[model samples]
Target: MALDRLPAYVRKLRNAAGEPVYYWELPAWARPVKDEKTGAMVPAMRNGKPMLLASEKLGSDLAEVHRKAQLLNAALTDWRKGAEGASMVPGSVEWLFQWYRKQARFTSKKAKTRADYGKLMDMLAARETKKGAPPFGKRRAADVDAAAADRLYEMLRADTGPRQASYAMQVCRLVWSWATRHYKVTGVKENPFMGMGLTSTAAKGNRATSRAEYTAYRAKAVEMGFQSMATAAALCFEGCQRVSDAFGYVDPDAPDRAAIVWEGYQPGVEITLVQSKTGNPVTLPLFEEVPGEGGGVERVPLYPELEEELARSREATRSATGPIVVEERSGNRYVERRMSNVHRRICDAAGLPKDMTFTGFRHGGITEIGDAGEDDVRPVSGHKTLAVTRIYNKANAEKARRIAGARRRHIAAIGALDEARTK
Candidate 1:
């Protein structure tokens, strides 16, 4: 919490409990004064003297402090310039985007997500049409129809690709919906970007990795002295965790980094996790058993590879204090990009496909569950709906085999009945 890095006109003070709190204050010149006759707060002056304004209390959370401070700064600028300081022409797409950025929905998104959306917005504002008359951002929101949105999508699809174009349209659709519902954006009734039947190509390169490929990748990683990477991949494949969640990164704001701790894990028993992306509580079992026909239970290790890898990692870092997946060279958690690079190296050494990414392992794990004839994958996959979980069920070989066997039995029964009737 550096004082110089904080926004202008913000003060940091300690509360009674010794916790820091933030507050925003406006300059006397820009502050609105209360009128004696109208009993209303308005910008005015009496005897050429400026009135004092109370400081606004921003929460102690640093992120919240920054968001509130930004909005207040915008207000201060508008007040200082009166009617002349509007950032953009009202009711324009550019204006809408700028406004939307100030809202909580945009500010509260993950940093990576916000940055991606920012790039798309900037591209939209700078893109030129064949006529070269004006950029799309300058167009009035009121004038934009479904046809105009379609043209914009087509232009983006041609310039970039279908994946990028679909994402851009999705973002615009959300912005339009938010503006329409929250603010009375003039002449903007229907959302033009809605229901465009967008088909995304985001999943084109990320095909599910096979179990054999995963095993080879892990073996290669371990041979290359990337023991942490090996365990991280296992977490993605066996635990069905995202890369970010599995190999936690250093958070500058927090005292401790987010990762799997030794306390949550009980080898050959169970492990608990609260997924960062969806905030869903996931408890994964390391061992399972089912009833056998002979009145005995057949034991199944839920994630035997992961369990063994984690055990080895614990033994190596027995004296060190931190996450389970610490770099052997450095006793720190593997950053997401570093992990991905190591995974690529392992894939090349293992003679696997170049497109086989660490993310695909998670998909592979879910698909394996589906292939095993699991009725519900939402619990382990942390998906809110069966629909979302079904997307990862790529290998339908077992399902097809079951249907084929049923059809064969039906044909055989039909032939027998027909022969009996003839006799």
Candidate 2:
């Protein structure tokens, strides 16, 4: 009905203050359209539900009721005047979401957060299409409402982990806010994720590994008798690198070029890398750690743990499609879930009690550093804190013996000299 137009609605619901009011009788929150078949004004339904206000004649606070009505009236009046066609709604929601993301106090937000935000939007659009709703190409971003937003979140909850789903929703709030402010897509002021909901399971993310767990995992990998996984797991345990960190960046031919040769302690083909998650620059030496001129690590100034493993794996596999680590069963790269399965299998075979994860290598690297007794080894592990690195670093037996033997030799020489002088 043209009477539902903002200008018309504003004129009809004016209070004494001259502010426009929202009609509580509208079926939907703000979609006050006239019914076509019955010619009755019907509101929008939430999950097929309509507003159910009871009619009772009792002495009530008419003043307070009128005050609320005035506020609602003003909102409805403003919405009528301010909202453009349905096309303007999307822009409004996007604007509102952008504003909220900036205002949020979420800490330790990973680097891919922006990409996740985009993904959340995409997921929401897909959901609307699935539900035969707006913004599915024909629907403008402006047509979204509380019901649309709820359905968007509901779609994401089906498969994604609760915490990840919550993250997606958190970002959605920002996008909806943008829609409201700029496009007036939905006039929801309060964030859907302000507190928590049945879907708000965001606390479980990181899963840490212990030393005993690593030991058992190592045994399991060996026992499973899967040469490929064992090799991958062993390389991981020895190097303390993410599986992708090892497989994603490898150049075996770098050594053949004179510019990229490992000349003892000198740097060769040193390139700075900004860790995808941390945004920290790391000078990566593109060389393999192998027996050099004197049985020491050769070929490059930096032969990272993963790099060495990658080089060895590539050397072994002449016709592999991708990644040094290949599945013995199918020769495919180990994805997260597959890697977990491998970890569990390896632990089971090795007689280890705790099911270790593929990430065990990172923790193992910490132990190797501690064993070497080099405080500088912390940075090499690609971790920010010493507390985490300490679990991986184990004391070197040879180095300990050397230090203790020197003190023992000195004491023995002094004792012999004292005995000779007394005689």
List model 1 lDDT by residue over 64-83, tens digit each: 68766765575455334432
Instruction: Give me the runs in candidate 2 sitting further than 4 Å from their true place.
Output: 1-165, 184-191, 194-212, 222-226, 249-323, 329-341, 344-355, 367-374, 382-423
Output the number of the lDDT-best candidate. Answer: 1
By summed lDDT, the worst window of 10 consecutive residues in model 2 runs over 255-264
lDDT string, candidate 2, 1-423, tens digits: 233333222223556787554433432355534545323344433332232221222113344334434434433443334323233333344334333444443223532354356446434433333522333323444555557556656666667766666777676665555444533434544444434455466464334454445545544544554545655654445434555553332212221212111121122433332233343333434343457786777653233433443444445555433344555555444433455666666666666546345665556555545544454443444455323233332232223223323323443565687899999
Please provide TM-scores, in order, for all candidate models, with all chains considered together.
0.54, 0.39
Clashing pairs in 1: none
Model 2 residue 235 lDDT score: 44
* Displacement of the residue 5 alpha carbon in candidate 2, Å: 45
- Shift in Å, residue 74, candidate 2: 39
